[model samples]
Target: MPPALNRTRLAWAGDLPTSRAACGMGFVSTPELGHEAVAFGVNALARLAHRGGLDADGKSGDGAGLLIQVPHRLLGGQYAVAALFEWDPRARAIVEAAVTDGGMRLADWREVPLDHDSLGARARETMPGIWHGLIEDPGVDPDEWERRLYLVRRRAEKQADQEGVRMYLPSLSSRTLVYKGLMAGTRLADFYLDLRDQACESRLAVFHQRYSTNTMPDWRLAQPFRMLAHNGEINTITGNRAWMRAREAELEPELRGAVWPEGSDSASLDNALELLVQRGWEVSEALMSLVPDAWEGRGDLAGPVRDFFRYQSIRFEPWDGPAALAFSDGVVVGAALDRNGLRPLRWQRTRQGLVAAASEAGVVTMEPADVVERGRLGPGQMLLVDTRDGSVLRDAEAKERAASRHDYALLADRVLVPVERHHVDLEPLEDLPAHHALHGWGFEDVKFVVDVMAETSAEPVYSMGDDIPIAALGRTPRRIYGYLRQRFAQVTNPAIDPLREKAVMSLRVLLGARHGTLEPEGGTDRELLRRHHPAVPTEYKLLELESPILGAAELARVLEDAVVLDATYLPDESLRDALHRLCREADEVSGVIALSDRRSGPFRLPIPMALAVGAVHSHLLATGRRMAADVVAIAGDAVDVHDVACLITIGASAVHPYLAFATVGDEAAPRYRKAVEAGLLKVMAKMGISCVSSYRGGEVLEALGLGAEVMEMCFSAVPSRIGGVNLDDIERMA
Candidate 1:
């Protein structure tokens, strides 16, 4: 099987690195390089282990696909996606950081010298586990890995506790998958990974995600600290550290070990200063005193502050190199990097209402603002995120640097023009799935589809729940259903012969309750049922409980009974829970329909949805594990197919006829594009080459009864496809 289809392999090695070898100390395969890297930015890096490239060119020219999480008011939700490489390396760093290649400890490091050769090899080995961990969620099943983490943290926590210390929570939010990459087994490593555990109280966020012990005032002592994440190499780092250490050559804070192990240089510098934050230097004072952009201020500064920068520069200039960095101690997420703004960094208030910064906008929510959003964040800009006061501060005069800088040699790099963008002109996006409606499958679609199979036909059903959602959507009129409440009425005839008026009337209930047409409570139920009731999801079709188990019930469906999941909430578990709940409610009377936003051959998830995770959903659909197995046993022989629940998910990359066919129409009306593109693909069994031609006219009208099909009547006219058989009917009959 191809790599993407292989479900058993630990995809984590391909994601998060665990061994020092993976982090860069070990072996790695390099790809032939070219312009692709230059076009895409950092995505050109196939395997992004920290490297001191020998005159390496930095560009995402390899054309790694895009990943982002941006605000979308339409669904009242956030849009997030991750492809290869856009991951947080900190998860693995936090681990491999325990020991060094020489078996000798290194000082706290804020920036890795880009020229160091060994930095690449040692760090390379530590990466695979990071990739592996990010792609593979520690399943509900406890295997050795979970046990190992437990042991490690337990031992580490004990070490901390003995000295009044702390450890990462079992939830491991700090073990973050900041970025990831892999498309059908292709390698992916996009950006630096920085993660914070998902806990009300964060360990990394709190006491020590970034703190490390260092020398202070001729004696060692425990001290609070400052943290920094760099996007560009700070060329001045070595000299700066050397000068600072000379200033306090004698002191070794005993608390250095308390915050971090000994010899953490960059960390010590920050920690030593943090030791002074409360005493005199405000945060700006401490940071400016350490990594001041330049001595010149817009105008005024306190004498000490002004005098401090003037003296600091005498030692060395500002840290150089490009960087989009962020750091926090659970209290404040502060960021400062090279004064030149040589590296890309964008920060903005998140939809969660928290301040965040990353090399890319999607890291926060994939906002374009992530990349200098419409010219925000000029050179010398610093962003301070104060969780304590819920305030954000910018340098204000930062943009002036761009105006002052020399321009004009012009004619280089295809005449780089600053692109202009306003609110997305959604009109051009018509016929693209999800203009008004959320475009992918949710939790409800799983059970609703199972319900459809159980109620649709008497033939032994082997329908793949990984089939297209539109197929399930069209089944209602044909004695088909993806859920019990589909029609909101009980089937009067089990055989459902010819599905006449009475049977169709039984469906009146299920079809009526869809979307906002009706409510789920008694008042609406009575009044609506009196005048016109919903077509019971059950009466429309009987569903099979393939596994006697499932999860989508909570994603967006109304469950037949109250349900609670047994699995422990792990990383990203909150999103999963919220989805489950959404399914339970939204898919109450009808079968749920999930859609994929990416090009997953079979899977689709909108936000933070890893590209290859389709298998997770595929496995769940096949096993029906989301629903309790007992539910299947109780139904017994009555239902033709054995299943606890069902799912009907359209592949994220599936041609969306509704959206594709739209030439000009919106939520209110739609007109599909006239031009058609023939997708050349390899078909099954014969497996040579095949062409699937699609268009915008009659075929779609035929599907909606507003158009007609011409190709031997074997095509669907949904705006997206030109000529095709009605796939739902095909799946059922096949």
Candidate 2:
């Protein structure tokens, strides 16, 4: 009997190496080189055997995989359809159903020839039941049929997931093929006989060796996904995945119910890229949109280029993290680095028209004289090869072409809502009367939070060995931000040093509704979202309240453009209901909603700023009104640097910490802002994020005591396991 479908293996199921490391290599030639390229790839894999992970049993490897353009010549010419399948009866039925549903007939079927016994007993034991089949659909365009197959595959996979069957397609394309598994590099070539075939040749080949830190390496999780292979971790994956699911309501029918596979962040990223490519986005555009550079504030970029990124930023969040990725569509092949430049990718071009890139230099050996050029990928850089043209495109040339594809400057300038025009003086908070200031800032807050800010102009740090109670174990109730510890980059990918790389960091943020796609019919209101800027010039429309402990003048300014919903004296149920109504009403008003706590004093506390901002932000997102409005946090409770960062991370577009600034005095306001900016930059860099905008609303938070239901609704996708406090519990604490 074939191995049971459920008994799949993963690399991290075994012991992990003390020091994390990973390696990947690829080779592409102009003409088909058959077994020669395969042989070289295999030999290179063998050379990197140390990089392959060990499973629990220690003998079996975690995973290894290779990708190549499909070799049609080996099949003896044109065929109607060709596909691989598991030998299970259920698998067969599912494929048949998919083909019929797609209105394509299976004219014939053929198994890929292989010697089962030739692979050792262990290899056979690890294998899934496998077969290759063919189909025929007369008069159907090949590309269209491929698309139909993609839909069919998704349908089958979804059905299998529902029915408890293991079904996957290593390669299901006429242009490219993928072969990967949970096997060591040394055994991969020996276990899969196809790698030895001289006829299996192609112009481009890329590969990935997994070193997953958080997830166990599973058979289906092996790399060199359909169109790309990713190295390094995506630190922003939680938020990235959440945003993808949130937009599902707007996705096409074929893409509906399509789920990301259960794998590492890299796998999920590949899933996103594949989805976009299938929807007809150019490979370069899709990648650039997902992994954009720090283009917003950089005076170095041409107006068109900056406009291109700014527009795309409105449509998608950066798949921000430490990434070195290689992508292809059989015609164009390329690789990119994360803006942090934490992951290493070195490339070399040969005189013979081959371009090779890997995690490390010298993965593929060649004579120095044969090398035409060699260089390392800089931060947020890309190296692309257009196989059809047989030419390489550097980052500037590639982005320039993408930018020129549309009138991005005109679109951005016309649609972006202007925030720079709203800039305000800091005079409101500075001239506050002593009694009002005293009411806003408590004595304890002044001594600890405010004095610390005055001394360092940054968030205070605890000594390394300082002991604190874990949220799960603490007897006392904890703040939502306190329960959610900040996660940082480690091991397989290093974090960036913000001070050393200040040029690439950005605090620029866009607030408002999406402008819609580049299509001509897109909504004008949607385009209004990208206009808000963090800089002082565009600061007014974003409205900075003097404080949540608002002065009379500040209250007057906010009331002009926004409706202030008082949470100051309301009970839990009434406040929750009022906040809900206010958020919905927020969109119809000007796009700003300021949550204030002016009535609260040392004796009476307001709702926790974290809870208020989170609840409001979550509601806006749930109602599809999040992009239509911006949440401005005005609170006396935000008396420290951490409080401000927490507010922004939880979805505040702009934070007005009236108490902290007031206590520090007017002369120190600019210093306070710089310190807050620097502190937030430090936080982002520690997580391998180069842009504050990428870090904003990213939800890289892990709540310890929050109930699953409350977290699901409010902090969606955050790691809130080991439940503790519910909304009632939080209300009592407040």
Clashes of each: 197, 16
RMSD of each: 30.6, 6.7
Off by over 4 Å in 1: 1-226, 249-283, 297-324, 350-352, 366-375, 396-734
Top candidate (lDDT): 2
Residue 576, model 1, lDDT: 40
Tens-digit lDDT track for model 2 on 1-734? 10111112344533457644764544443433455545555655655555667654544566677777666666554443334446356876777677778787765555555545433444446567655545554357766766776777787777777887767776566567777766666556565667667776767777676665778666677777777788777877766765665555565666654447366787788777777766666788888888997785468777888988876766677888777898887667888887767778888887877677777777666678988999988878888888766788888888888787666765555556443323244434443444244333445556755667667777666668637697567666455566777778876767888888788777666544442332221233334424422121222223322122233344445556665655454553543554455455554644667777655644445666676777777776665556556666777667665667777777776666766666676666656666677787877778887765556677767777778756865677577768877766666665
What TM-score number comes out for model 2? 0.83
lDDT of 2 at 388: 69
Each candidate structure's TM-score, on Cα atoms with residue i matched to residue i, is 0.26, 0.83
User: Cα lDDT of model 2 overall?
Assistant: 0.64
Alpha-carbon shift of residue 218 in model 1 (angstroms): 31
The residue-level lDDT of candidate 1 at 341 comes to 47
